[model samples]
Target: MAAQLREILLRTRRHLLLARPGEQPSRLAGEGLDFRELREYTLDDDIRHLNWKSMARIRKPLVNRYNESRQISVGLVYLNSGSLAIGAPVSKKDLAVELLTALSYAAARSGERVSTWFLGADECAYYPPGRRQGDLAERNHALATALEAKGEPADSEQLLRELGPRLRRRSVLFLLGDFMKPLDLSALASRHEIHALILRDRLDEELPGGSFLLEDTGSLRRKEAVIDPAAREHYRRLVREQDAALFEHFRRHGIGWEKFGTSQEPIARLAQYLRRP
Candidate 1:
């Protein structure tokens, strides 16, 4: 199963690298020196790009255009929490690693740098951004080791606190975790383009009818509960309410957000998420 997951991740990386065009250049910034064209200047146009000579000859302000020269960078925040181990068939932590591997490889293949931070409550790991595709194996091994290491319970609050100071550049940041707590990401969004990928298990939202024992991975506390209709409905409603609130928060902050089930195809969901405007 591990080998298969790795293969799928590699295939997805190849697909993303070979097919997707380069990121669209921000109209406000361009690094290329090769002038492409000149057009009438708009109010928002940078005065630095204005062709003063052209304006003097034509009696109109014009802006020089050039292709985007700077490469893209992808920042990843991977959560290593005990709750991620609660899932059927495949654990959420394992799936998260697989998806993260795909994203990192794809970014590197596209000539973009990838910076990763693995967060646990007890410890945190940082991997510097690098664009060399040949270093992927070493990077993947380091990431896997970090995720599997036993540590204190990880939470969104800790992640938010630690991530803010580490972002040295304006990059697209992918924050991956099972969001079980409330988050205020408005401030983080101001410095970086943020995308929140929420990992969930169907069992969490819909419990099977039966008596079952549950354990809190973080606290190591066990409890017995009966999944009666009323209990099940209440659980589902709570999950829905939490998710709805989270969605609204992200929307207001201009951060992209999506929830993916542990059983879903990681690559397909990622592609769908990226395809959105």
Candidate 2:
């Protein structure tokens, strides 16, 4: 386990080193006083940064961009729900850990203060913001330990309510979860730059025809069912609808997101997402 963690850390470091100087892990605009540039306003741009004078003169909405602070605050939220434990050969939970580790490591290496929160239905753990290498290691160890324990249903409402207040400073928050339930992150998005890392297994969308016994990880309830062609099609349609609604929600609220499968390497996918303009 330690060796694997080391490998992930090394890989993330290498990726960062090879990345172009202008490519940043998070958005560039922040609370810094130095003016970077003025650009046309986009949906993702914070309304608070809108330059009213410029808009009045140009007859177009524009936002002032400020250089990001030397040490930005980064928040990592791991939704340790039992649903994540359900995956194929590689569980969604394992993939989530890898993504979380890479993000935390990258943030710390870039001189950003990293704060981590591990949240389950009935429990929560937090590691305060720190830039030290030892602090990053401790956060990673705690995250691994939490994932190994039994998982419960995710209380996302409670998470939003509790976590929002704890993060006093404006931050770039990354939420890692299966997100099998409905989500409304409008309030949180308004205050912080939010990104959702959605983890899933291939089986989630495609189920083979067979009689099988399935257990609800959240409730630990067992049920027997047969998957016919019709049933499979119905399930797939529902998944598609769910994903469409999820993406729409992200778009409406101006939140960034990416979907990761258990079979894929998370670090590469994450790097690609971070490099987006």
Candidate 3:
């Protein structure tokens, strides 16, 4: 039953990922293949895909066998930098894990490769892509562990430096966080096409309209802020500025970006972004 739902989700995702028949390959924010493999050259095959090594071994030219070009490989970075350890209905960290998993699974089932990276403040935890059921279980367990752990602080600029050595093929990357600070994103902005999912709970976006002690559940730290006009405006401006900066960065680098709220609209909003050309 769950497998059926996964298929349904994958098909839905594929439908959202529209591509012209045999036109520009789906490598960007679209459903595309995971890897490009080389197979034995066949008649009517494109000579451009010929592998030189297979030529020596089989005494015949080998051709490229791309994993259906209409799939997109996705890499999700579940950021829990102590900042996202806030809010209700669903914890920010848990929400990030769920959404990232949904996105990854959708891509993976659509004949794409999906990976998860847990950026634990200074370092990263990687779950390499695999089709095996056990591998998927390991990925889920790793993500849950990350959701429980705390991130020291994140420097988005320095992240790609560590990530560059790992990823060989181009893949879509998502950085999910509450993004309350000005993160230097120049490095990652260039290396991979990054999409930032700015996560915010009901309190942050909708505003609860009451004075309550803002507390971090993970750390039990508390701060008192008057939920009045001044505080509201202050927060609104700050969020807008950060959002604008992120948007501008993506635009400048030609990186496709989307922001997901912690409310029920996340999947819908993300689905809309995925539907865009």
Q: Please give the CA lDDT of all the candidate structures.
A: 0.72, 0.78, 0.62
TM-score of 2: 0.82
Model 3: number of clashes? 7
Model 1 per-residue lDDT tens digits across residues 97-187: 7667777766676667788888878878788888776476347644664566244445657766777677677778888888776767777
lDDT minimum window of 10 residues, candidate 3: 20-29
- lDDT (C-alpha) at residue 260 in model 1: 80
RMSD of 2: 5.7
> Looking at candidate 2, what is the lDDT of residue 66?
79
RMSD of each: 6.1, 5.7, 8.7
Between prediction 1 and prediction 3, the one with superior lDDT is 1
Off by over 4 Å in 1: 1-6, 19-35, 38-68, 149-157
Best by lDDT: 2
Flag the better candidate by lDDT, 1 or 2: 2
Candidate order (lDDT) = 2, 1, 3
Pick by TM-score: which candidate is best? Answer: 2
Q: Could you estimate the TM-score for every candidate? A: 0.78, 0.82, 0.67
| Model 2: CA > 4 A from native | 26-32, 35-69, 149-152
Candidate 2 per-residue C-alpha lDDT over 1-277 given as tens digits, one digit per residue, 9 for 90 to 100:
7787888778777665344433455452234478899999887665667899999998999988877655678898888777787776789888887878888777776777888888888878888888786468556755664665345745658877769778898889999888777778888898888999999898878888999998878777999999999999999999899989989999999999999998887788888888676
Native-vs-model 3 lDDT?
A: 0.62
Superposed by TM-score, candidate 3 places the C-alpha of residue 235 at a distance from the truth, in angstroms, of 2.2
